[model samples]
Target chain A: MIHANDEPAVPMGLPLPNGKLAMWLFLVTEIMFFTALIGSYLIYRNGQPTASQPWPTPHDVHLAEWIGAVNTFVLICSSLTVVLALWSLHVGNSKRAVQYIGVTLALGCVFLVIKAYEYQQKFAHGILPGRVFEKLDSPHGYKYMRHVQEQLEHIEKHGGVNDKAKKACAELLADIRAGKLQPKDVNERVRGTKSIKETNPGKEFITTKDSTYVDLPERSRPKDAPMVEGILEMDTHAHLSYSIPFGNMWASCYFAMTGFHALHVFGGLVVFAIMLVMAWRGRFGPQNAQMVEVTGLYWHFVDIVWIFLFPLLYLV
Target chain B: MSEQHHDHSHGDHSHSHGDHSHGEHSHSHGGDAHGHADDAAAHFRSYIAIFIALCVFTAISFVFNELVRGGIISPMTSATVIMIVAIIKAGCVAYIFMHLKADWGKVYCIMIPVVIMCVMMIIVFLPDGVLGWR
Candidate 1:
């Protein structure tokens, strides 16, 4: 029979304490979860068609690498603080442990705040998955030509074409009237369209199609070009329609991986808050210092995930 | 055993057995207060060094990407180097920050199977997902 004062027998073949082993087991599940997510991302990324559906680069999506780098630094610093907190506890320094944990908590908040700002920017740009860009093969050229035709007609009605350019304008009108320049022909050459403001003082009031101007290159024609060309050139600001190929797929992966990771960070912040309270209450000392170390393990795992993610998402 | 229990319970009778047991275990390994302080100092310095190394790795990745963008280095080379650097950073975090180096317990026994499972998942999915076989 065991006496009241007898120490409890260690579990057979169990090398670690129960709490630590359980934490490691939990991390194993987490590792699998992230691995699956990242694996799927890689497959999708690698399988993308290079020519037809090229993946969008970081520039195409306006992802700021410096911000990501700063966040990485923040996380690394937080990881260091977490370890320091655990170290302080091991040395029986409860006040310093609480201070370190507090710093870690603040760093976590900074990371989330920065993440929230990035997400806001993405939303503002309409960069959500399935809506990253206009449909590939869209009839943007046809629409652009139709807008051109309308602008030409408006110039004719308003006598906007000067005498020096009337001849060229009439010739261009003949081409359109004779079906020489079909919508499909222009559509084939049209990549994308963007809105521009009319820069010429005289043409400022000349209403164009959709109340927007399309600026074509002035190098395409002479200085005293035709009315249509002149109207196209009047706008100094040219909006080009550029498509981000397979952008939806990229956005989906980016959001999923980073979103899940952010959630884990938030969870860690909550745990740190709790730990901070416990440390403040003087509950954490050499006796219960393992608690801080266990928590630090999870925090470090989060940092490791970000280390991989920083290069994959931001740098690459 | 009784004396050991008595020494642990002397100061922290309110703490649970789990807490005291862990404390006793670490203390057994710690030897004395002076030695424990020294170990903690070494750990502190190591953590600082690792943090600096991590920051440098992050900077290297950033600079490598910039070089690729500037056409000073090929994208392929930059990508390879950045990935290698990322893996090294993760390894450092796992090995040192996670305390796996100091405490090599059954955690690896738990980790090995999970690693194999992750690898198997990738292998199984690669064919259909990447090669478009199915």
Candidate 2:
């Protein structure tokens, strides 16, 4: 241990212990960094179009809020464990400190694992951002593409949709009118072209010779939806798509903010694991214990940032 | 050696300083093992209390979010309530867990200015159609 008798108590006019002031200053800068990202998210959330009164129907972000809530609890638990680690080390219980830090690190991994799973779900639904954003296979778009995927699968299995598929195709015309369309009322909006009210179970949709029809002018066109001579074709293999109201900008902000936050959690997890090892090796004795305290400050800061981030992104 | 024994209240701190000395072997809080063990138990208790409080607050925020979505509460009011609760939760973590209550001086200078900059950034960087000022 460094000799306490050698070093002066106060290095400057700043009334703080060694490295404490520096750490706080660094955290303050982090506050500014995250503030910029979160502010943009707030603005985007406020400005994004709602599902009500759909004109140019925007992509309503319907993510699994349950996952977000669970992650929040996980982060909170990790924060508690981190503080407990510092407490254990402070009291000269190095073994318990190691235990607590281990828990904190494990919880951090759990949070990331959940985050990765959520990202995978979004990828499957084609929920992407900016230039690569594909509204055609968006969650809403997937709903519209359900029949097409089934028909394609049928064709692959038995060489084309059969009687049931053709019957299903014939019934879908009830929803389509080859002209300009409007919602019946302010509360009413077209989610998809109308199919028959009753189901033809186990039926495959088949496109007949006269099955081609012009698409009714939609509120919005997805990037990948195809049109031939300004007319939407009836082939279920492609063309039909769904879109959110003003989806692109929202996707950009959500991905950027949450993505960066997850990265920070990963970095903290590594740091905590190292510190856990240090504690077990008897390096975090009270005289030189400021490292554990400082890192705890950082982990807590990450937790605090998420405290604000949780409601802002998922709830609000 | 004295500095090594100075962290009397690491987890459940009260910030009561004992005239700090740069001299060797000036004090010893680690001399009392049994007393320290009792104190450790106390500290863990407080940690448990704080964790429970944080969890309850989190649940409340989730409930409020659902209420806002269901239109049981006005959106603006719900937002206000959630932010206020978030601030409180952050306070507990910063003070109790991070031990910021034991700190002052340079931290305040750094913190106060950064907070001001945060508010300014929000106003300046707000995106289009938020206030229709665009």
Top candidate, metric TM-score: 1
Tens-digit per-residue lDDT, B78-98, candidate 1: 889999999999988987788
Question: Candidate 2's residue-wise lDDT over A1-316, tens digit each?
Answer: 7798978765444555446557787888889889888887666656543222121211234465568889989999999988887776666666777788899999999999998987775564445674221234234333434533443344444544345434433333223232222221100122232221111111112221211111222323343544222111233222222344444565677678788889889889888878766666767445534666777788889999889878776765
For all the candidates, what are their Cα RMSDs to the real structure?
11.4, 10.6
Cα-based TM-score, every candidate:
0.71, 0.69
Please tell me which predicted candidate would have the highest DockQ against the true structure: 2
| Candidate 1 stretches greater than 4 Å from native | A1-13, A139-242, A280-284, B1-31, B124-134
Fnat value of model 1: 0.60
Residues A1-316, candidate 1: write the lDDT tens digits.
8786696765564456566667888999999999988888877876743322335567556588899999999999999999888777666676888889999999999999999998987775557796544332336445545554554465556655455344444555566667687443332222212221111112223333221111222212244644233322332121212245566788899999999999999999999989877667767566656777778888999999999888888876
Backbone-clash count (model 2): 11
- The TM-score measured for candidate 2 stands at 0.69
